[model samples]
Target: MSKSSVYSWRIDPVLKQDLEQAARTEQTSIAQLLEQIVQDWLYKKSSPDDEEVQQRLHEAASQTFGAFRSRDSKGSEKVRERVRAKLRQKRATQRPD
Candidate 1:
């Protein structure tokens, strides 16, 4: 266990009541809930900016782009044609002679 210290501050009675209710609902003590809230806020504050996120997404897409491409140059059109053909074959097989 780590060392702990007590800190007190004034808050509106209604807000205190809401905090208590929330802590009870979460099955945690008010101190623990407050600690978790502070930790989450710090984590979010340290997250990457929008440009960094976009750069990361672009890098990932570049790495995986055309990874599943078919031999044909028009892979998407070929895939659609193959799917339609399979569906037609299935429907024909299900029909009575």
Candidate 2:
């Protein structure tokens, strides 16, 4: 255990009530809850290059990558043909100038 110093500041009544409720739910004092919250925030702020963060980001990207599908499995191969067909349809719908 380390020596702790007193810190105080004013906050909104509603926010203070919410914090008190959270502390009660966690079975902790408001000061201890605040200390844990501040410690967690500081840990995250200080570890931008942490491996756990990188692994989470990689997992998210891997899950989302190529998740969307077209009716045709070979859609990538037909992009140019699709664009040409759409352009022809648009031109036919337009009045000639």
Candidate 3:
């Protein structure tokens, strides 16, 4: 004869309440519900199609963020305002020239 194994985990109060409500509605135990979720997760994780999508997402993120680039702040807000005002004045003068 073989023996069954048991495991334990701590869940948040709100999550536990929600699970209990769902289990009651489905006429199932929390353990069974959790087992079904884990089985589905394992199946999806082992699928090769999901792995390719995950890799593409990682590559896209790296490209969008400029691949680990650092930005240096050469001018403060006051300096930026002054520079912008000067540029605007220069453009206005050139328009009349």
Candidate 4:
């Protein structure tokens, strides 16, 4: 491991208690647990160009929008139509001078 540096971060008491319990359950120190957690988060955040991340993002966007073939969207058409209708009705009620 590289030389450890002093990086102090403050967390809430309840979360701290939970972390401590998790550390105890894992037979590790709080520092080790936090280090592992932070490392994992860093790995995920920094892997935007990774193949797995790219594939997952593409899959999610495709699932959300792939079926949108017409002028109206597929999944959210009802909500969009309702909002547009409400907006038009509201506009019609306005006084245009």
Report the poorest 10 consecutive residues by lDDT, candidate 1: 63-72
Query: Each model's RMSD to truth, in Å?
Result: 9.3, 15.4, 12.1, 17.2
How accurate locally is residue 40 in candidate 4, as Cα lDDT from 0 to 100?
96
TM-score of each: 0.50, 0.49, 0.46, 0.48
TM-score for predicted model 1 compared with the true structure: 0.50
**Candidate achieving the largest lDDT:** 2
Clashing residue pairs in all predictions, respectively, total 0, 0, 0, 0
lDDT for model 1, please: 0.90
True lDDT of residue 88, candidate 1: 100
lDDT of 1 by residue, 19-89 (tens): 99999999999989999998899998899878999999999889867666457788776778899999999
Give the 10-residue window scoring lowest on summed lDDT in candidate 3. 66-75
Candidate 3 segments whose C-alpha is farther than 4 A from its true place: 1-3, 50-97
Q: Which ten residues in a row have the lowest lDDT in candidate 2?
A: 61-70
Q: What digit string (tens of lDDT, one per residue) describes model 2 on residues 5-65?
A: 8889999999999999999999999988999999999998887767888899999899877
Q: Which stretches of candidate 2 lie over 4 Å from their true place?
A: 49-97
Report how far off residue 46 is in candidate 4 (Å): 1.0
- In model 3, the Cα lDDT at residue 97 comes to 56
